[model samples]
Target chain A: MLTYFVTETNWLNFISSLVSQYRVFGLIDYEGELKWRRLNEANSHSITITKYRSIQPIKKFFFPVKEEVTAEPSAQKTILIGCKNCDLNHLKTTDSMFVGSPVSDPYYLKRRENTIIISSDCDDFRKTCFCTSMDEDPFPSKGFDINLSPTRGGFIVEIATKTAEQLISVRKHYFQDPQPILLQEREKMRKRITELVKNNNSELNWTDPQRIVSSTYNSKAWDDDIASTCVECDACRFVCGTCYCFILSETKDIWSRIRTWDSCQSAGYARVAGGGNPKNTRAKRLKNFYACKLVYRKENFGFYACTGCGRCIEVCQGKIDIRQSLAKLKKLEKNV
Target chain B: MFKSPYKSIKAELLEVIEETSNIKTFVLKPEEKFSFVTGQFVELSIPGVGEAPFTPSSSPFKTDKIDVTIMKAGYVTEALHNLKGGETLGIRGPYGRGYPVEELNKKDVLIVGGGVGMAPLRSFLLTLLEQKEKFGRIILCYGSRTPEDVVYKYLFPEWKKVKGLEIMQSVDKCPVGEWDETVGLVTCLLDKVKVDLAKTVSVVCGPPIMMKFSTTKLLDVGFKPQNIYLSMEANMSCGLGKCGHCQLGHHFICKDGPVFTYEQIKNIPEPFA
Candidate 1:
């Protein structure tokens, strides 16, 4: 574990230098919202290089929206910047399914192996964000090549992996040993941001998500009211950082099997042939979606499927709030 | 080099047997030999069309070729039905948990299948027949919509001749013609036969509603929940269980089971539904 201080000027120079060797992708302010974009020679100036998590999730970096699984590996070396702890935590869920299985997903494994992740600590929280409720820090504790903590005029970089150490050694001139005062300031900033997120999500109780969800399976709170608000557009699932369900379709031209993201909210998601649908009703389907995040996933994978990234809330057309829904389920749990 | 679960090996269609108007049995010879235990399924793929999971109806002992009995139910099946012999198709897996044949040794086995649900059971029956002397009495009670709808009708005569085995066929309703089998639900056939409740290991596969009713009847006839096996089918996309389509409660049908004991999944809400 090595720590370094890269001044704002040197950080920008480091980004520019890396562009020649690796495909560098970083968060940029796009019409007020942050988005992940490739930092080319032309767009390098617009790169935010901040602590904000992008609107687009990190999932697509490894598992694209649609990818031909039968194709040969591209094996492109990539550098990802400004990933928050919430998005980085989702890799654990995906890794359990795609990598930890008896049959590993070569596509995901190849991308994961080649990509260098530089996680940034969040200084602020979105109104819908609730990472604290999910027992996650605003700063990443693990699963990153390097973690960046923003401070005045520079960033305190903590290298967590051999890849990141090698990356810094290659561009060692841009980095210097951090001062004691700078390290203290970085810790204080992390604590303040964590407090803000905790205060914002105080109303939502996730102390026992599994217990609450199990008891509230038949709760009327998830009835017509919630069902009516959901248009079944599947925007939430598409935007979710940890949703790994996908449908495979083959193209006539390429003759390759392509895997694309799928949502449980879709009518045909759980429908078998001969018109058998277990989650037939909209309310039932919605319950299953929530249960997957709160209960089912924990039972299967030993962790909640949701990373508390708040992308689902931001993307939902009907303005459905997961925090509010979980609070409601908790209320129903008390009654039950 | 890591082997990907999504990668499909090429399998050439060797023969096509039209069991009924809508149902066809495809016999495929894989470029690389694909072997599977009884009651396991494979994801059959048509190049342009998509893939769907189908249990092999052929015996595991016959590794040279595999048989998949499919009805023209949806888009993938429709595309599969249009294909001719010598055409190449992609095949992945032999996935999911198969039947526990070792547990059935020296025990009377009761197999009940309805309509095209008999496909997976056919494999189980054939495998059991191969080791008939190791098992006790074997009873197969099958039901179809009509007399003409019955699959593997040609094999019934041969199946009956096996030692200590009894085959009974039933049709829900037959056309106004020469029909020689019982006319009623498969559950009705249970009344005509005496089941060794304590010793019989019953395997039931069919439409959801039929399976639900059959399990209730089997229980009423004194079969233990642990002894009854169910072939649970869900809409499966990834046979490797990465796709969440086939999730039934906490269980992934593609991984945890396509076959589960009644006692194993009985507590899960809506196990049949």
Candidate 2:
């Protein structure tokens, strides 16, 4: 790993240089909401390095909402920037689902292989943010090609992978040895952001989420509370970084096979012909969705599926907060 | 880089056998040699239409051709039924765990299949018959909706002639025809057959309700959960298990099993539900 201090002006210039070589995507303000957009020479100045997190997760870069698995791989290289820690953690779950074992998804693997990831620290927290409750930090500790921590007038950059190291070596003059005082300031900023997240999510009860969720399989809170408010719009699943369940359909003419994002909340997700559906009711489907995040995925993939990005909370039309639901599940566990 | 699992191998439809009013068995010859053990399934794709999982009904030993019996119940199958011989389609696997025939060598076997569920069981039966001398008595109790819905009707007479094999069939109702066989649920046939409960391994595949009721009856007849196998089906998109549509609890029906012993999946939240 190589650490350097790059001035804001030089950092923007490096980004501009990379934009000419790779398709650079970063966070920018769109209608007051931070969303991912391609960073070009014209808009490189407006790119934010300290946004909480992008509204759209980094999943779309590697696993698009829809793609043809049999199609040719893209030739252009891609660089994703300004990714938060929560989205980076989600890469772990998606990796296991798409890249592991007896069979792997070639489409996702191709995109992942052709892309470089650049993550940044979160300087602030949203009202819906709850990564700390799920035992994840707001800033990434690992699993990125490059990491940027906002400093006074520049970025404390850490090159974690050989790909990033090679990319920076081409424009080596822009990077300088970090001063010890600036490094200390960067560490303080990281800690302050972590504390802010913990304090913001303090009201939510935290426990062994896996144990609580497994024991509360029959909890009335699912039907009596969560189910009542859930509109089944599937917005949360669509926005989630780790919800990789997909449906394979053909075009109307039947010439091409298409793989598109699917949601468990949908009525037909688990339904088979002759109408045998395990998760038939909306309440059961909602319960299964949470169980997938808390229990089922952990048992299968060795980790909780939820990265606690809070995107689901923001997009949910029913105002049904997953943090609140997990808290309620904990209370129900105690009652039982 | 490994080849994409989603890529389907081409197979030419050799012949179509109409098993029932709405069900047809399409015999296909893969462009490449495809081999699978009895009780395994393959994803059949109609180029532009879509793909769905169907276990080959043909004997695994007959590598030249494969049989897939489909019911005209869904959109994909509806498209499949409209296809003719000499047309090309795609096939992906021999996915999921097949029946454990090697373990059942010296044990008596009881197979119960209902409706189109008989397709996979047919493969199991034909394979078991190839080495009939190695196993004890094989009893198959099949049921369907009506006389017109009975599949493999042409093969029953020949199957009865096998040394120690017994075939018993029942229909839920007898239409306006000369129906001489049993006219009750498949579970009723279990009472008429005699077997040493300690030595029998039961395999069942059917509609959800039939499987549930038949499993209860099998239990009532003293069949151990470990000795019972089920060919479970769900909406499978990617036969390699990348797609999560076929997931049941922590198990991927496309990977962990399309065939699981009752004891293996009994504790999972909703195996039968």
Model 1: DockQ score: 0.63
Q: How far is candidate 1 from the true structure (C-alpha RMSD, Å)?
A: 2.1
lDDT of 2: 0.87
The TM-score that candidate 1 achieves is 0.95
Task: For each candidate in the order shown, give its overall lDDT on alpha carbons.
Answer: 0.87, 0.87
Instruction: Mark the 10 consecutive residues where model 1 chain B has the least summed lDDT.
Output: B1-10
Model 2 CAPRI rating: medium
Best by lDDT: 2
lDDT of 1: 0.87
